[model samples]
Target: MIERLQLLVAERERVLGHFLESEQREIALACHSIARAFSRGGTLVAYGVDSAETDAAHVAVEFMHPVIVGKRALPALAPPNDVRGVLRSGDIAVSIAHGAEPAPVRAFREQARHRGALTIALTGGDRVDSDHAFAVPSEDPQVVQEVQETLYHVFWELVHVFFEHPGLLDDACITCGDVAIQARVVAVRNGNAVIEKDGLREEVAVELVAPVDVGDMLLCHAGVALERVE
Candidate 1:
């Protein structure tokens, strides 16, 4: 029993270490997206059910009640008993789910899409079955749960980073490559697979930097590797 417990502890340490290793990249991606939303004057709304509710609440509290004064307090709303408020375009709905395909999550996702808000789903699944789920990739249930917490805190930290570099996003709006907008993946004809981006279903090439499987969502902007979604 003691040995098993020790092994679990060791595993957790490894998982946390891995998350830390990728911290910089994750921070960059998170800050970039948050900046994009903020640029358009959007608020952040976090929502989660079950155990993940704590994460949602944390996001809300941090923004609503900052510990330090004179700091930028973003308009962050948390999961409510009822989600009826139609937030602005700069608003975001972040969810943490193990399966990544649940009714509550889907409801929030649909609402965000309808309201023209961003949907950031932190998921722990081998494959993402939802329309847009950011796969954190965890096999162990405990690790999945713990990693969700890790990612939530990390994302909050990145939000602070974005605030520091406010000028970078607001000032220069560079033209990201247009590859994603014009990408397509088509069926192989004879010996080659053709890629098209003209809205053809099967012949649309997805310029994904990471290997994409049967189910995944590409958060593509001009074919740049901003972030991977499923």
Candidate 2:
């Protein structure tokens, strides 16, 4: 019994270490994106099929009723029906699955993406069509679920870091005249551009200029770039 327990503990630790090391950057970026979504008054919609339903519910509750005191509650829910029914643009869509995501979950995630929601997939190391995907290193269903649970809890904790800094998120109400602001594109990802102006960085929609690249200067207004500055 002691040997069996020790082996299980060791495997869990090994898998967790690998998961964290491989997914640290992805995890950070996902948290920031979730924070930005909340800043834009977007809700988080968590969903899954079968046993994964438990994880979806856990994520919703954690965001809607934070465990840490003084942290503001964020809008989140695990819809009992199709996630697409509640998904909206700028919202965050999260799906939990083990190895081989069910067809329905994949379909729902795709639908959410089509509707302009930020998609997050917690799966067992499968390539998913999402803005951010974090996979546990182990294929063991129990291990995968446990690590994903930890990931979401970490997400809940780290997302607050961005909220503490107001400048990191876009301010929708800050607009004056028809004039636009010129900013240098620092980074671009998933239809959004991270632009820097006088050392202040902000994300703006770059869909109008689909081919935006780093170091490109753009004319931005109302949280979206109108065109490139030549």
- The number of the candidate with the highest lDDT is 2
User: Per-prediction RMSD in angstroms?
Assistant: 8.9, 5.3
For residues 1-230, write the lDDT of model 1, one tens digit per residue.
99999999989888777766754554455556675576677877877777667767876787677677776777778856555365565477676665455678667766665665656777666433322245655677668778777766666677777678776566331214443333332222222222323322222223444344433434445324344443
Lowest summed lDDT across 10 adjacent residues in model 2 is found at 168-177
Candidate 2 clashing pairs, residues 3+ apart or interchain = none
Model 2: CA > 4 A from native: 171-230
Candidate 2 TM-score, true structure as reference: 0.77
Per-residue lDDT over 82-171 for candidate 2, one digit per residue giving the tens place of the 0 to 100 score: 778888888999988976688888988888877778889989867575677777766798888888888999999989988998787765
Q: How far is candidate 1 from the true structure (C-alpha RMSD, Å)?
A: 8.9
